[model samples]
Target: MSTGITPSLFHILESKIGKRVLVVLDRSFGFEGVLATVSQNPPGIWLSDAEAVTLRSTLGNPYPQVTNRQDKSELFINLSHVLRVEILH
Candidate 1:
């Protein structure tokens, strides 16, 4: 957690297009996937499964993992529910 001036989440997300990221929601849940697109009007992130990343649990931390289900191909996450976003290389 750097104390540098953080940019808007939207701009940060926009810059992550086509990259893998871990998005933590306010509810203590999160997912790892490739950022496909960003919506402004409604505010959401579209994640694709093409280059999906799986969440791993360590120690007692129960990290949410993405499954290979039919409906798991794409995920739409509301920006309002996002608490933090971490870019993965």
Candidate 2:
């Protein structure tokens, strides 16, 4: 992840409420899922249990293939399975 710029798509989700943006999650070694932002909760340090579950479901399934965007590559990981949340900016 890079510094001084937002990293987690969740944060981007929170920041861009009512706006549309691309969300990328790390599914595996290379696979990723791209989603269109539809809604978001207020800025917070953590996501609620319900939010986590909802995010997880959106991830669907992990893919063996990876995604390359903005010269970066990451897998699509389920947010519900995430252990920690970190901010880059």
Candidate 3:
């Protein structure tokens, strides 16, 4: 959880609030959406307008395919499964 930087994980995630982010987790499962809130009780994040992303390798495809999960408007990500979070522009 320690990134060797001065800022902690909570601070890092906090800085990303109100922005679009791509949160990558275990088994190539990712969530793409806007950061809605951060909580300590469950140590997770809530994403608004969220989409479940599945990263699959394809022949000759350099980029992974992204999916928009309209069925899931919001998602809660457990920090334990999180690998990294990419702040989207």
**CA RMSD for every model?**
6.4, 13.3, 3.6
Q: Give the Å shift of residue 78 in candidate 3.
A: 1.0
Q: Provide the overall lDDT of each model, using Cα atoms, as 2-decimal numbers.
A: 0.69, 0.31, 0.78
Rank list by TM-score: 3, 1, 2
Q: What is the lDDT of residue 1 in candidate 3?
A: 50
**Angstrom error at residue 32, model 1:** 0.8
What global local distance difference test value does model 1 have? 0.69
lDDT by residue for model 2 (14-45), tens: 56443322332333221212232322232222
Clashes of 2: 10
Model 3, position 36: C-alpha lDDT score = 93
Candidate 1 C-alpha lDDT tens digits along 1-89: 33232348679778879998777773435766789999876678898873333445556776655432232577888777777777878
lDDT of 1 at 82: 73
- In candidate 3, which residue ranges exceed 4 Å CA deviation? 1-7, 57-70
lDDT winner: 3
**Predicted candidate 3 versus true structure: per-residue lDDT over 12-86, tens digit per residue:** 888889999888885457888999998765688999998888776577976555643444688898877788788
Which residue pairs clash in candidate 2?
Answer: 25-75, 25-76, 26-75, 26-76, 26-77, 27-75, 27-76, 27-77, 30-66, 31-65
Query: Which of candidates 2 and 3 is the stronger one according to TM-score?
Result: 3
Of 1 and 3, which scores higher on lDDT? 3
Give the lDDT ranking, best first.
3, 1, 2
Residue-pair clashes per candidate: 0, 10, 0
